[model samples]
Target: MTRSTPTKPQANPGAKPRVIHPWPLRLTHWLNAVAVVMMIGSGWQIYDASPIFGFTFPPLITIGGWLGAAIAWHLAMMWLLVVNGLIYFLWSATTGHFRKIFPLSPRAFWHDLTAALTFNLKHEPGVYNAVQKLLYFGVLCAGVVIVLSGLAIWKPVQLWFLTDALGGFVIARYVHFFAMAAIAGFLFIHLLLVAMVPKVLPPMITGGRIEP
Candidate 1:
């Protein structure tokens, strides 16, 4: 009788997951996630006081029971978010991570855009594409806008200049709302992209690449 041949395990094609996110990045990232979630919930509750839409958001999705509680929660989360974001940005700048994240050349952006549109998006090792650069930078800028607008709304009398530049208190409030919406949208898309490339997320948590 002929001896049966044993089957070999299939090899992983992509590069082994590595420590892409350093300790600082991972910590700040998770902290940011937590803060943002808290902010969203508390924000909804606060919005209930003067909802822009026809109806108020469901209580189930909101953080606090009343306006006062909501404001407290919102303020608390805001501080956490601000602190974590500052740390992240500072670390990235010091580590020269900005070069990988911020697209400076228009040619590179065009190439990346073409790749994305053609479903040929390339995931470089430890590098972000043009789309990612733009989106991330946009989110950061939006956060700044939200913070400024929130301050204006929260203390219109004290921060009169901000409110005035934003076309007064009501307009500032709307800007804050819109900025929050943009962040929410980005969060959704970010998760979707992660789902599409499951390998990318593990490094964020474990801080090491998974061996193929």
Candidate 2:
């Protein structure tokens, strides 16, 4: 008689659970959010001191009372953003998270983009899509530009080379401002996307179901 082959156990159809963000990433994420908020508020106040493009943001939403206070707040939040950003990047790199956020090839990215645009994008529970990876990588680069430009303008004489490379003090200042704007825009888009996929937020908050 012929022996029958054993089949693997099947998962429950009702089971739709997972573990996404880990403790370290979640911690850094929240910290980074607070830091960014602080930076934006103070930055607006500081900008009021020298109204860029002949316009100034209203005081109602601005953080600091004056230029001096804004400078202090901005500097304080800068350190927090920089330190936590560094830690998050380092941890993600070491833990293989970087690979998950970066597409393996241009062809793969093109395929993903076409799928997304056509509303045929496949959603993997905890995997980053090509568009998501591109956005994430772009944001990372924006962060680096902001930090470098901020430093260049903060001490033009001390960071002379950076200032010169960026086409002097005024250019560096403008770059910093635009970089902040890019990040702010990203925040709104990110939130909108998160709202569309409600399940993703819960995983980010509670670290998802570990054994589901």
Candidate 1 local accuracy as lDDT?
0.86
- lDDT, candidate 1, 73-184, per-residue tens: 9999999998888998899899887777765567877898798778798785457887778788888998899989999998999989989999999899889999999999
Please provide TM-scores, in order, for all candidate models, with all chains considered together: 0.84, 0.86
TM-score of 1: 0.84
Candidate 1: clashing pairs of residues: 17-209, 17-210, 18-209
Error of 1 at 16 (Å): 15
The residue-by-residue lDDT of candidate 2 on 1-212, one tens digit each, is: 99999999888878876567889988998999999989999999998898657888999989989999999999999999999999999999899989888655788889988987687877766788877887788888889999999999899999999999999999888999999999998888788778766677887788876445
- Full-model lDDT for every candidate: 0.86, 0.87
Candidate 1: worst-modelled 10 consecutive residues by lDDT: 12-21
* lDDT, model 1, position 69: 94
